[model samples]
Target: MTAGMPAEKSMNFGPSARRLLARLSPQRGQVLAVAALAVLSVACTVIGPKILGRATDVIFTGLLGKQFPAGMTHDQAVAAVRASGNANVADMLARMDVVPGRGIDFTALRNVLLVVLALYVVASLLMWLQGYLLNGVVQATILRLRADVEDKLNRLPLPYFDGQPRGELLSRVTNDIDNISQTLSQTLSQLLTSLLSVIGVLTMMFVISPLLAVVALVAIPLSVLVTRLIAKRSQRQFVAQWTHTGALNGQIEEAYTGHELVKVFGRQQEVQAAFAAKNEELFRASFGAQFVSGIIMPSMMFIGNLSYVAIAVVGGLRVASGAMSLGDVQAFIQYSRQFTQPLTQVASMANLLQSGVASAERVFAVLDAAEQSPEPARPARVTDRHGRVEFEHVSFRYQPDKPLIEDLSLVADPGHTVAIVGPTGAGKTTLVNLVMRFYELDAGRITLDGVDITTMRRDELRGEIGMVLQDTWLFGGTIRDNIAYGNPNATEEQILAAARATFVDRFVRSLPDGYDTVIDEEGSNVSAGERQLITIARAFLADPSLLILDEATSSVDTRTEVLLQRAMAALREDRTSFVIAHRLSTIRDADLILVMEQGRIVEQGTHQELLAAGGAYARLYHAQFSAAAVDLDEAAAAGAGQVPAGVGPRAGGPRPRIPAS
Candidate 1:
């Protein structure tokens, strides 16, 4: 979602500026020192022109008497002087202040140049030092921002991820952070330097000639107006660019990740169209932002050039009419250019600054996000499986005012495998999601070992509940890593042991790398059956007091299914487990099979007991295995009978033959 437009969204430059300043906290001393040196440099810059102007004026008024040669006639000297009266003339002149019969006093002018040059050197050195310090601050700030963003991502509730694309999250963390970095590392300090220089130049202009300075500065406000207009247009476009970039990245991720499905469906053209649309959106936004910001610099230069012409024409006429000295006009032109330089700097840098701000806004939007339903202050370190679970009159809704499970109650004793079978959207997942404390309950309580789950720390509650979701997702790491994900502290020996318990050893030990072989994200590189086994191994490694297997065998072939079934039976030994599945046949061995409808358990009992009762459970069981052929295939697969390949395990497909009944 785009950032909300609150009533307070108006540009408050003061706070943003303050935030920028605060990031330079530790280096403020260096900034101040550099600023002082820069001021000295500006002082020298203004004074040098005045000194040169004074020298020219003094020479024009004959303030410097001729150190003319004695042989020179008055007429010859007068002719030379008349020709040199033009300000553009550069004829050699002798100083009036020279000691007679000695030498010209060149020391004053030399010292003036030396002082100015020294100030420039000092200023340059200060600027370099500032560059280093500010960069260090910028890098440090970005690192902190990234770290904080990551921590937030980790802590946010599971539902948060369910609603957002992974690619968008990646963009926020990586691309957005890079934007802030580029702005800080390059444009930020330059803007500051230009702004400071502009201020100093303006002050100098006022001191030298206020009236002329005002005329030169007329362009400053005009350029700022143009910059603001351009910036407003570019700002909207930059926001759009980043948003579309994220969407495009998400589409690409989905495409590559789902390439097999896409090709199988022959939806290449469909995917191409979607991608093209997203890419075009991104391209247009980027181009528009760039084009608008690009126009700012040229506009600024136009205004600057116009200002320069105005100052030259006006000041030159004053000089020609004896209202100002030629030297004064020269100094005035320099000051006029100085006035526009800062405006140009602001225009050039505004684009970078806006991007950084937009990025920060996104980043802060995450940081400012509501915390993952707060955890317990001091959660118990729950290790022992007094796995007596109870959902005492619990109620919940994913959305407010739209309750899913209401006033529902259920219980499972320790070491019992509870199979909960329900139709789609009957609150099966919601019940478990609440039990895991992924989402808070609206009413009532769920307890494990007589302690309410909400009162315990989320990590502590989840730590003991090993989960195998219907759609298994593994990380980009080794087999060992995936197995040990549920409990990272698991020893290598323990991981192997867990793998063995889950039948993972059957496939894993045969692999070229065994436990060392890496798996892609969501186990994309591995066979579906193997991935299921890996997750089962994860549960085994966790050795949790409670286990949740949601459609654990639904995605696997019958061959793997048999192995998983055996492993499931083994895993149920001496632990509380919740089995959620639509394939009701597989959960026949559960200690308690619950037939749920509309978030309420209509029937629950042992297989034979439920069958004898001829209730909802019995009806479901019969509905599932009503066919004689289905019974024969299942029975044959379980070793009591045999079925030929053409007959299949279910309707249509052929099934592998086994022994006859």
Candidate 2:
């Protein structure tokens, strides 16, 4: 399986190809119409050479039948069929045309030429019509394909994204889709035209002269053999090329998006080196595939020219024996060339189709990814007005083999603040993810207001909870638009009130454009604290019954934090809230405090009670206080220019001091 391939590996080339064709179901009528036009185009083109051959025969007969000044016709005028072991039947036959010019039939020859030209013009028009219709069908199919991909993205589980790079997925959506479009527009039409051309040319060759047709037919197997050999080798390279291109895309997205981190870590050279290596691999693979496929046209052309020469030699002998006409030999040579033309075209298209298939495989892989299991039949529906949440013996893991949360249980009472305090990697965010149904529980169940959450729709459960994470997300839009995202129908008054509550209005009013100031995609125009404030304002506007604050205030300054705390306190008046914080001071006044270590709750109680118990919470609280005191003392000592014993600027650092503050 390729990197980023979906778990459903059973969907092979046949199935993926079938799935792609299925997209054309709605446009079947249009497809048939285009095909009919293509066939007509081929028919007209095939008959043109035969009609031109008739004109050649007319002119040849005219020259031969005309009486010369010697009173002998052109045929009787040439006494010898061969001279000096040289085969120039045409030269020998035309030797008596000195005075036959007056008897030549220009009127009949003109009529045949006009018919040939008319057929060619009609063929060209039909081809253009076919292309115009096929283009519409191709675009319609692409539109549906895009819609399917977007729908698939919405249905896929969050863990699927967690394991795949955004750039790779983006490539599947943009690059892969574009590949399919190009293939449909260019390759498919060419394929149909080429196949029809080959068939039509073959029939014409045999009609003109079977002996020469045999020579022309020989080029088919040779062309096919060459195409097969090159396609086998180039197919693998094309697949690799697309895969590497996707990988390069991923690397570029990561490096450029996190350019600040790269600069800060001084890894500019490393990023460039990594990109260069990936790009080099892509280039080599792309060049190999293209070079191999490129040999087809020239190789087929050589075989085509050889066939033409063989036909001319054989047909000249037959014509001298009175078994063939000059026009027939001429048509046979033309047919031989036309026959190999489509063969070479099909060979080239074969290579192009291989690249398209590789892209299609990646696209199908995403569409085939395991989606979140279907919502249960007759799923229970419940409202979380009471805001009571419970986890009953819940166990979960991102990877099934490596358990993260095991047999954990907890309950948050209605209208109470439950502060979950844990060290990093203690599964703080996982708890929130479980409640949001972002990841389904491996064992046991969670409930909202005494109803099993699993029985309810995931959207329903998530709708009741508002979340503000440590990393704030804001799209490229005005401040008012960002806040209104959570509540699109929010009135101007409601929008202003939410912004005011989170102190977002303070900064917004200062800006020249105020609420209408547009931010970029990364929201780089604003400070981190300001972005966090905007997210908070968004949540406030949502007014979800249950609120989750996962280090929501970590980015703000002390003054902003104080204001945010006051704002949250007001919002939490009659709602159930879960606050996950590293700063114990932020959640010190919670109605319930759950001290966690690893993935289990080691201690739970009111803040003062836990402190009196001198457990993990008490130790954590004292450590923070001691760190604050040491910082203050160190600043004062620096001003006084004196070192405290075993504490300030010592070779060994002092242990965290437990001040009485």
Candidate 3:
């Protein structure tokens, strides 16, 4: 199964194709206009061949009539032929309205030629107009479809993104949509024109000669059979081609995004091999699809040629027996070619149609995904806007069978700093995520200042909170622009103040462009520590009543971290803050400390109290400090002389002194 795909795939071609066509419902008026114009244009085109046949007849009759005696009347000429024992020839000549005693009449022939030319000219104009209108209809339909897909994306929950590959999702939104546009643009008007031409030509063929028409009709079943056989096989290949396309895109995106890591680990060959495998899969699928569908046009043309040959033989015999006129026979031959031409065109378009519907199915998959539950229609508001948060017997699980957090309860009063510490996979981050309502609870509820969080709109609840995560994200823009993202309407003074408070202004001032420095798409222009600082500055600018810092200062050096800690101390003065950190020293001054293990709080108290209690928090703190003490002693023994006990590492060393908490 493709990443993030629904359990049931919409692989049926008929339903998917019909759904694609349904998108054009909004442009019904334009579609109807295009259809009407196609009918008129085909009517004119079908009439042109018949009128041109008259011109051929006029020239032929005049040439034959002039060969007879100069003064012979029309009846005398026919009687002369019959007297000569050529009764069939006499009957054929009787059907022609020819003046036997005269040479070719150029005036009547000119009139017939003029009418044929006029019919073709009108046909061309109508075709051009229909194409213009259909372009609008196709573009409008695609525009609306794109909008719906974008809207659907915003409504999807975070877990949907967690399971989906970024590159695969991008392919559906961009590449798939582009393919659909091209298919509709190239196929819509042409399909309509081809179908109408087939109908108009078939009508004219039967009118001219039904026996010959029946001979021409023999190819229809053969054509249909060949098309069905080829299309059935090629459709599967087309689906595989698109699926491989998305997989290849996903691999390429992951490789490029982690190019530095790949180089660091010396895994370039492995990455290349994976890429080659995916590329080969895509190539094979594409070749199979094209080669199979490619056979259809020639197959159709061959069948039509057989019918053409049979029609020519039968029409000739009928003309000789005087059952059909020379002019009508000429028209019937033209009609046969016209009838077969449209079938060939449709056959040639099979590959595009198949590929287009495949892309449509992928796009519809995104649209049909289950969305996040809707927000409350009449949402409750936090009137006083205090930062107090409470979790009342909250229970949740990522999977239905595996319970992660069960009946957990906690509370942080307004203007208090609550610090959480735990080993990996202990639900530390999950607790903070619950406060943000990133996922809904399986049972019980969470509230902010006594209002149920679910009852409040997500945007409104998130607006009053600021977060700085462990992984910093920065877009391509000036540093000033990135900082301003946290508060779009913030003044220049406010932005600069936040930067100074977070110690970002210190290093930024030493750079060439300072605040105006442009970051690359990956933010490679700056160090990781600087990137983290920028995110911190952004959160500071937001200045929310609630703040959550998840290892926010992990990337910075000791001196910079010390400066940031002082700034954070002032920032946390009157706001409720939830700080999750592995570095115990950073949270020693927090108002309350909660040590968690396996999704439950094993201990909670002030730092000194927890250490004296000799519980999980004490073990964690002693373990961290003992490791630091051992490292310092090892460095001293390796260097000059064994240093005295309880001393620090060499000055300006990589490791910082372990302060007493």
* Model 2 clash tally, residue pairs: 0
TM-score of each: 0.84, 0.90, 0.93
lDDT of each: 0.75, 0.83, 0.89
lDDT of 1 by residue, 570-637 (tens): 66677788989888777878889887887777888888888899888777777777777776657566
RMSD of candidate 1 to the truth, in angstroms, is 6.5
Model 3, range 443-496, lDDT digits (tens) per residue?
989888889999999998888889999999998999999999999999999999
Pitting candidate 1 against candidate 3, the one with the higher lDDT is 3
Clashes in model 2: which pairs? none
lDDT digits (tens) for residues 275-319 of candidate 2 = 999889889978987998788778888887887788888988877
Give the RMSD in angstroms, all C-alphas superposed, for model 2.
4.4
* N/CA/C clash count, model 1: 4
By lDDT, the best candidate is 3
Best by TM-score: 3
Clashing pairs in 1: 64-96, 65-96, 636-641, 648-655
